[model samples]
Target: MTTRTAEMLMAVVMGLFSVFLMWKSAELEIGWIPDEGPGGGAWPFWLSAIMLLCCVVTLFRWWRRATPESRSTVQFMDKNTRRINYITVGSLVALLVLTHIIGIYFSIFLFLLFYIRFVGRHSWLLTGILSVASPVFLFFFFEAMLKILLPKGYSEPLFYPLYQIIY
Candidate 1:
C-alpha cells in the first residue's frame, strides 16, 4: 500500500485501540477519589482519551489531505531498505524472546553489541564500551536508585555482588 493509505489505516487502528483502553480503564474508576489523589485508572483513561483525540485529528487531516504524510503517495521503502527494516524488527523480536531466557540487561547488552558493531558498522571499542556501560547504567539507575528491579532470568546470581554493594 501507498504511504498515505498505510498511515491512515494505522491511525484508524490506533484510534480504536485508544477507545478500547479508555473503556477498560473506566471500569477501575477514572476520576479523583477525594481522599485519594487520583484513581488507579486515571492515568490510563486520560492518556487514552488524549490519544483518541490525536487520532481523530490525524484522521481528519488524512481525510482532508492537510498534512504531508496524507499527501504522500510513495511506496514506504525500497527492497534493500525493506530488507534492513525486516531484519531490524526481527532482531528486536528475537531480543525480546532472548530477554526471557538470558535476562533484560544481558539481552540489552547483546542487542547493543549487534546493533552497534554489525548494523551500525561502528568501531569495536565503541561497541564494547556501550554494550557494557549501558546495562550497568540502567542497573544502577533502575535497580539501585529507583528500587525497580528488572528481570534477571537465570543470570540473577551474577548480579548479587553488585546488588549487595548498591543496596
Candidate 2:
C-alpha cells in the first residue's frame, strides 16, 4: 500500500490501541493517593491519553493532507525493506524463544551480537563491546542493585558464584 494509506491505517490502529490501553489502565487508580505520590496506573493512563491525543492529531492531519507523509503516495515497503523487516521480526522472535531456553541475559547478548554485527554491519569492536556490556549492565542493575532475579534457565548454576558474591 501507499505511504498515505499506511499512515492513515497505522494512525487508526494505534489510536484504537491507545484507547484500549487507557481503558485497561483506568482499572487501577489513576490519580494520586493521599499517602502515595502517584497511583499505580497514573503513568500508563496519562501516557496512553497523550498517545490517543497524538493519534487524533495524526488523523486530522492525514484528513487534511497537512503532512508530507499524508500527501505522499510512495509504496510503503519495497522488497528490500520488507525483507529487512521480516528478518528483524524473526530475530526478535528468536530472542524471545532463546530467553526461555537460555535466559534473558544470554538471549539479549546473542540478539545484540547478531543485530549489531550482522544486521547493523558495525565494527567487531563496537559489536563485541555492546554485546558483552549490555548483559553485564543488566545483571548488575536488575539482579544486584534491584535484587530482582531474572530467569537464568540452564545458566542458573553458572551464576551461583556471582550471586553468592552479590548477595
Candidate 3:
C-alpha cells in the first residue's frame, strides 16, 4: 500500500483498538463515587470513545475525498532525509520502550539529545535548550496541571523536588 493509505489504515486500526478499550472499560464501574472521584479509566474510556467516533468520521471523509492522484505519490516526503527519518523514528521507539523502564524525563532527555545532536546536527546551545525545555513543559503540563503521575524510575527522583513544587 501507499504510505498515505497505510497510515490511514493504521489510524483505523488504532480507532478500533480504542473502541475495544472503551468497551472493556465499560464493563467496569465508571461512575464517580461520593468520596472518590471518577472511577477506573473514566477519562480514557470516554475520550477514546470520542476519538473512535472522530476516527470513523475521518475515515468516511477520507473514503469520499481520496483520489487516485493522492495514491500515485509514494515520495510525499523528501527521500534524501531517509537517515534523519530512521533516526528520529528509532529515537521515538526507544523512548516508548524506555519510558516505563527509566521514566519520562530521562527517556525524553536522551531522545531530544540524540535528535538534536545527531539527526538535526544542531548546535550544543540549541540541543541544551531543547533537551531541558521539552520534558519540563510536559512534566508541568501532565503532572502538575492534570494531576497525573507518570513513571518514576532510575534517576527520576531527581525531578521529585520540582514535581513536589509544581504539584
Candidate 4:
C-alpha cells in the first residue's frame, strides 16, 4: 500500500483504540472527586480523549490532502530497509521473552549489548559502558528511589546485595 493509505488506516485504527480506552476509563470515573485530586480514570480518559482528537485531525488532513504526509504516495520501505526493520523487531521480541527468564535489568543489558556492539558496530568500550551503566541506573531509579520493583525472574537473588546496600 502507499504511504498515504497506510497512514489513514493506522490513524483510523488508533482512533478506534482511543475511543475504546476512553470508554473503558469512563467506567472508573473520568472526572475529579471532591476530596481526591483526580479520579482513578481521570488521567487515562483525558489522555485517550486527546489521542482521539489528534486522530480526528489526522483523518481530516488526509481527506483534504493538506500535508505532505497526507499527499505522499511513496512506498513505505525498500527490501533492505524492510529486512533491517524485521531484524530490529525480532531482536526486541527476543529481549522481551528473555526478560521473563533472566529479568528486566539483564534483558535490557543484553539488548543494549547486541544493539550497540553488533547492530550499531560501535566500539567495545562504548558498548560496555552503556550496557552496564543503563541497567545500574535503572535499578537505582526504580528500586532505590521510586521503591518500584521490576520483574527479576530467576535472577532475583542477584540483586540482593545491591538492595541491602541501598536499604
lDDT scores in order: 0.93, 0.96, 0.79, 0.93
Looking at model 1, the pairs that clash are: none
lDDT of 3 at 13: 95
For candidate 1, the 10 contiguous residues with the lowest summed lDDT are 74-83
Per-residue CA lDDT of model 1 for 51-121, tens digit only, reads 99999999999999998989999986778889899879988998899899989999999999999999999
Instruction: Give candidate 2 misplaced runs (Cα > 4 Å).
Output: 1-73
Which of 2 and 3 is the better model by TM-score?
Answer: 2
Identify the runs in model 4 with alpha carbons over 4 angstroms from their true place: 15-67, 78-85, 140-142, 145-147
| Superposed Cα deviation of residue 24, candidate 3 (Å) | 15
How good is model 4 by TM-score?
0.60
Per-residue CA lDDT of model 4 for 89-149, tens digit only, reads 9999999999999999999999999999999999999999999999999999999999999
Tens-place lDDT digits, model 3, residues 59-165: 77667656443354474456667766777788889998898789988899999998888777999999999999998888888888898878867767687688668
lDDT head-to-head 2 vs 3, winner: 2
Which residue runs of candidate 1 sit more than 4 Å off their true CA positions?
Answer: 4-73
Predicted model with the maximum lDDT = 2
Report the C-alpha lDDT of model 2 over 1-167, residue by residue, as the tens digit.
99999999999999999999999999999999998788999999999999999999999999999999999999999889998999999999999999889999999999999999999999999999999999999999999999999988888889999988999
Worst 10 residues of 3 by lDDT: 67-76
- Each candidate structure's TM-score, on Cα atoms with residue i matched to residue i, is 0.60, 0.58, 0.50, 0.60
Q: For model 4, give the RMSD to the true fold.
A: 5.4
